[model samples]
Target chain A: MTLPKTRWRRRSAARPDEILDAALTAFIEAGFDAARMDDIAARAGISKAGVYLYFGSKEALLRALIDREIAPIATLLAGFAETGGADPEGTLHLMATVAIERLSDPRFFAVPRLIIAISGRFPDIADYYRTEIVERAIAALSSLIAKGVAQGVFRPVDPVLAVRAVVGPVLFAALWRHVLRGDTDVPPARVIEGQIDLLLNGLKP
Target chain B: MTLPKTRWRRRSAARPDEILDAALTAFIEAGFDAARMDDIAARAGISKAGVYLYFGSKEALLRALIDREIAPIATLLAGFAETGGADPEGTLHLMATVAIERLSDPRFFAVPRLIIAISGRFPDIADYYRTEIVERAIAALSSLIAKGVAQGVFRPVDPVLAVRAVVGPVLFAALWRHVLRGDTDVPPARVIEGQIDLLLNGLKP
Candidate 1:
């Protein structure tokens, strides 16, 4: 028996990435509850049925987007201590650098905005972010700071608070860029550099 | 013509403040678009006409809210130097404490969230904030930092960037509490203290 194969199968198979990209825009522009699947499909040049075929539902699509696009950069925190950088200051600086680079991408920044905008209506997004991104980053950064304090390379500071100190500024820069455009947000890279410079000094013994 | 004898006139004369208070709660709960004038009136225990008599329109109400509620704290930065703190570190610490104390009020924090959430759809709110609040705060904070640097109390860093370094984290903390409340945002007071502690060292000459 010969299957009646068409170009649609191959096209639909490749549609997830494009659909996800469109979904990001849709989610940002319209927000979560107001975002329509058809709009996303239309933006991606795919059919409604194809979107459903690939993502199954909106929740699945969001989860897929987070896992595929966001979780990797966020998970960079997990391997941070295992990575290169001999000095703790250098290591923390590296983390700031990586965060700035990763979050500079509008796509990455959009996810958090979507999470912030939607988390009110959808409580799980908060938990998802807290567990998936914030907790991991805090854990990794805290470990690095703890090492620095132990090695006498850095002054003693609450590792958790110190990590929040670092993350808060970086996250703020990203949030400004994500939420409002124009002259509102200072360049994220500049903020990152400034934050790391302050940290390098502030964490000194 | 004889004026109609009614208690409504007396009530409506007292309407603006109560209406503004109710407006804050309504705006926070339902957001700007979804929030209804009737709900605000009901919440204020005033007639709908009383709200209109006082504020005129929603835009006018918002402007009054900013002028009455947010603009005052923003203007507080203007007199910061004239205030009773002796040293620059103490001055900056004072500023941080004042910021934390003032912003910890849910009413104040809610204004920023409403502005951030609705600014995309309503550009005026952003401009209103930029002028009436943000620019004021920045200008004041910049002056404070510049004075510290000149007096040899703080290192010479770009006051603008330094002001940002101060504000970004504070704003982030406030935003977390405003946008996604749970265990996510560190209490504003703790962030303020930690930030000031770091600033004390980082800005030391």
Candidate 2:
């Protein structure tokens, strides 16, 4: 006997990954405040109830999105950390290359824009970002700097401050290019190389 | 007939400076989103109508707040620019000192917070900030760096990138400490000096 087609049946059988992918696209297009559950469901070709079943609410979905996006970056850096920090310049170049490559992905820019857009209304989300994503990134960079200092490869520097200086410029450059200037074609690698060179060589007579 | 004592009369007579001072405090305390015109008027001991009489809307008040707060800073830097990059180290120390001093001011922190908060909600406000404030500051710093290099007082560097590296760390450090970390006691001067040192002397061994 053939079964009758229903929205619930379609939703129940839908993949979680497909739902998340659709939700991300919806969130990017309309922002968190404007994005509706129905839109996400529509994008996923599932029922609205199915989205709620998978991700409790819109806020939960956003949290899940952030986690899903940041996890891979953290993992990649974790792997880089295992190699130690004998070469400061090479390590920085590698990190910058990887960072630029990741940032080229649409999700990277979209996630931050989403956060900044909703940060005022949802302070907790911003707080989570600071503690989870920013602090973790800083800690990773700090450990690498400390390792480099111990090896006497890089100059003895305050690891925390040094990490801030190195990472801050790259992040702001991307922000300026993508968010402010709306110039995605500007090569992130060139900007990163210029910044790395500036950091390595002081503007001194 | 003798003049009748009225709250409206008293509020109407209040000075523009006093109203702005109160608005700044209110904006800082509750932020742009939560702050009310009535509260600002009450803080200034004026009526809400009196507050509106001077500034047409909440956004206009914010724009005025930014203008009033940053004008003095622009004036101070104007004096620095007039010196024509004679002493690079001295000029840097002076600029760093001014940044540290401004960070110490509650108004400096509050104004930016309000702007950031409002900018998230209003795209035009953010556009005004990018064009008027951020770009202008970058231009001034870039010109100073170019002059310094041409005067043979500093190393030949990409002035634009160098200025960004030199300024970004200091600005973010203040934002991190005050806004994010909420640590008022953190000495900004020491941090600024350290950043200046880092910029003058590269991190290479």
Maximum-TM-score candidate: 1
Instruction: Give interface RMSD, per candidate.
Output: 4.0, 3.6
Report model 2's chain A TM-score.
0.86
**Runs with alpha carbons beyond 4 Å of true place in candidate 1:** A1-12, A33-38, A46-64, A178-190, A202-205, B1-10, B33-38, B45-64, B82-86, B182-191, B202-205
Q: Which consecutive 10 residues in model 2 chain A have the weakest lDDT in total?
A: A6-15
> B158-184 in candidate 2: lDDT tens per residue?
887787686667666755654545334
Superposition error at A93 for model 2 (Å): 1.6
Mind sharing the TM-score for model 1? 0.82
C-alpha local distance difference test of each model: 0.71, 0.71
Q: Weakest 10 consecutive residues, lDDT, candidate 1 chain A?
A: A175-184
Identify the candidate with maximal DockQ: 2
Clashing pairs in 1: none
Error of 1 at A188 (Å): 4.2
